[model samples]
Target: MTKKPRLAVLLGDPAGVGPEMGVKLLARAENRDAAELLLIAPPSVLAAGEKIAGTKLDVIALRPGDPLRFEAGRITHLVQPEPAGFAKLGECSVPAGQAVLQALTVATELAKHGAVQGILFAPLNKHSLRLAGMDEEDELRFMQQRFEVPGFTCEFNITDQLWTSRVTSHVPLREVADLITQESVGEAVHIIDKALRSAGIARPRIAVSGLNPHAGDGGSIGLEEIEVIAPAVERLKRDGLDASGPWSPDTVFIAARRGDFDAVVSMYHDQGQIAMKLMGFERGVTLHGGLPVPVATSASGSAFDIAGKGIARIDGLQHAFDLCVQIAARA
Candidate 1:
């Protein structure tokens, strides 16, 4: 019999819908049947989530670093004490941030030590993370720093079967043009290619979106396609990769959604994110690619306003869980 992969799950940003979504995910018997789980967070946090979900959780309590034989159909946890001044729903404060950071830290360590095969986190409030002393710009960067990963790493936004990778993420729009060089574009293509292959797409077809409007209109609108984007595509082709593009950003995704390409290497964040969200906001997932251990989460943010309302959707988090399992099982 094949053993199920053990995954570490965290309820992120206690003040947001993360806790509620996590509760909903665990409420399903199928989720527990598919994989063994290690749910990390304070008991109070889960209790609060259960209140919103209207269903109590079945969890085996354990401390961090405690030895146990992980079974295939169960959820375990190392509970962190609820911090002082714990913020309520819709409040982004240091305590909420600290809880998120602490959960992520422990889950990641479990992955690093081979105790868990992958990690999945619900949406987190970036503002709270910063307030908790996370000096890095985002969780991906923070994870890279913590793991001391030496190779390339990026966040992959996925909707349905289509995935998108960007050349520059979390940068100002004004600086985007300057950042789109041949090296940068090629790197984006490479990473997306690797990500697609990891997700079981063999010989993945990739589209590279041009930086300028209408692919620079042959230098009439802009010259980035002529000067930077096109060359990267050609270079990737010469290296025997099934890559094609410098396609006009406007029309590329339409083809990708219609089954033309396995993924798209976008010039910047919003170039691809905007389209993916529009395509399937409820089913989108952001995967942390090129990490030694698989990591993923809902592409949507923490909906603080709807935290305790129990109306927050769980589709995105469910998609994240599916992808995490797919990648981890293969790993």
Candidate 2:
């Protein structure tokens, strides 16, 4: 029998819908059957989530130095210590940030030591992360630093039908063009291709989006396509990757949605994000591509306004967990 992959799961933020979503996800029998989950969160936080989700999980509560076990029909929960001044249920606070950071830190360490094959975290708020002293631009970068990954890395957003990646993310729009180099574009293409394959796509057909209007219109509109993006595509093709384009950003997604490509590599952040969110805001999964250990989370942020409300959606979290399980099993 194939053993289920062990996953280190974290409840993203105490003040947001992350805990509720996590609770709801664990309540499903199929998810438990698919992976051995090591849930990391404070006992109080889990109780609150259960209250909001209206479901009680049969969990094996583990203490320090307990032997980890994978039991059928039960989750193994490692209770995280509550930090000082933890945030309230629906408000962002420094304590919330600190608590999330500590959870992530522990998960990363577990992955580093090969105790777990993957990490699945719920939605996290960047504002709260910033308050917790995350100096990097985003959580992906922070994970890169934590894992000591030296090569190129990017986030891949996935839906049931399509996937998208970006050459540059979390930077100002004005700075995007300057950052779009042939090397960076090639790296983005390669990483997405690799990630798709890791997710079980045999040979991913990657569509590379143009940085400028009309893909430079043959050098009339802009030279980025002619000079930078097109050459990068050619290089990727020559290297035996099934990559094509410098396609117009507007039309690239249309082609992808029409089943022309397996993934689209965009030039900047919003180029792919706006479309992905608009297409499936509730079911999008964000895979931290190129990480040694599979790490994924919901593409959506912590919906603080509806934190304690039982109406919080778990679709994204479900997709995230499923993808993590798939990749971790392959690994």
Candidate 3:
């Protein structure tokens, strides 16, 4: 028999749709086939999800150092519940933040121990991260610190065909001016390079988007294209990456959507996300590149708007799982 791929599934934000969406995904037979799902959540939270998902799930609860409690068609609980926290549905609270952090802590521990093939996170709010006193950096930075991982790490969200990234992430627009340096854009190119290779793309055709309108109108509009962005693209070409552009932000995405490029590297967060979300927001799934182990992607948070409504989509989680499990097989 093919041994199942072990997955560390973290329940982010007990108050939101993480648990509920998790239950919905695990109950699908397809997930069971791809991997063995383990839950890093409090028992009460898993039970609540089971109740909300309308299934009599056999979630096995366990403590640290205990044998994995995994069972077919069930979630193997790996952590003790928080001492006290809110367990409400569809409402965000301070306690909800604490719960999400606790879940991430457990997932990281599993990663450090090499007990699981990948970390599959549900949505976790950035605000929750701050309330938990976790330094409030994005997951890409946090995971790097938590696991002591060396080298650059990046987050990419995949829709049906489009893949995207932020030249600067989780930072202020004011900071963006200073952040758009040759080094920063070069870092993005490298990330796109590594990520494309991981996603099975060879000789990736990378498209670089401009920070200013119409690629700075050939220095007729803005100098950022000439000063910062263009230098990076020149360096990329010299390094032998199939890289090109300082293209018009307006048309680069349309070009990528038409298969002109393998991935599009944008200047900021919304530049890439706005289009990806528009293409198919619910189908938008996230991926982390440059990690030694396959890391399953998810939202920065839970979507309480559809929590317990049985309408929240798990396509993101499903695709993330498929990405990790398939990679695990090759690894």
TM-score for each model: 0.96, 0.97, 0.93
Candidate 3 lDDT (Cα, 0 to 1): 0.76
lDDT for predicted candidate 2 compared with the true structure: 0.90
What are the runs in model 2 whose C-alpha is more than 4 Å off?
Answer: none
Query: Order of candidates by lDDT, top first?
Result: 2, 1, 3
Better of 2 and 3 by TM-score: 2
Candidate 3 residue pairs that clash: 123-301, 123-302, 124-300, 124-301
Q: What stretches of model 1 exceed 4 Å from their correct place?
A: none
The RMSD of every model to the true structure, in order and in angstroms, is 1.4, 1.3, 2.1
lDDT of 3 by residue, 60-170 (tens): 777888887566666677766663666567775677777777777777777778788778877777776677677836766777777888765667777776777768877
Clashing pairs in 2: none
lDDT score for residue 187 of model 1 = 82
Q: Candidate 2 at residue 228, lDDT? A: 93
Clashes of each: 0, 0, 4
Q: For residues 20-114, write the lDDT of model 1, one tens digit per residue.
A: 99999988989998788989999888899889988888778887567755555567867887867777789889999989988888877778888
Best by lDDT: 2
Check candidate 1 and list the clashing pairs: none
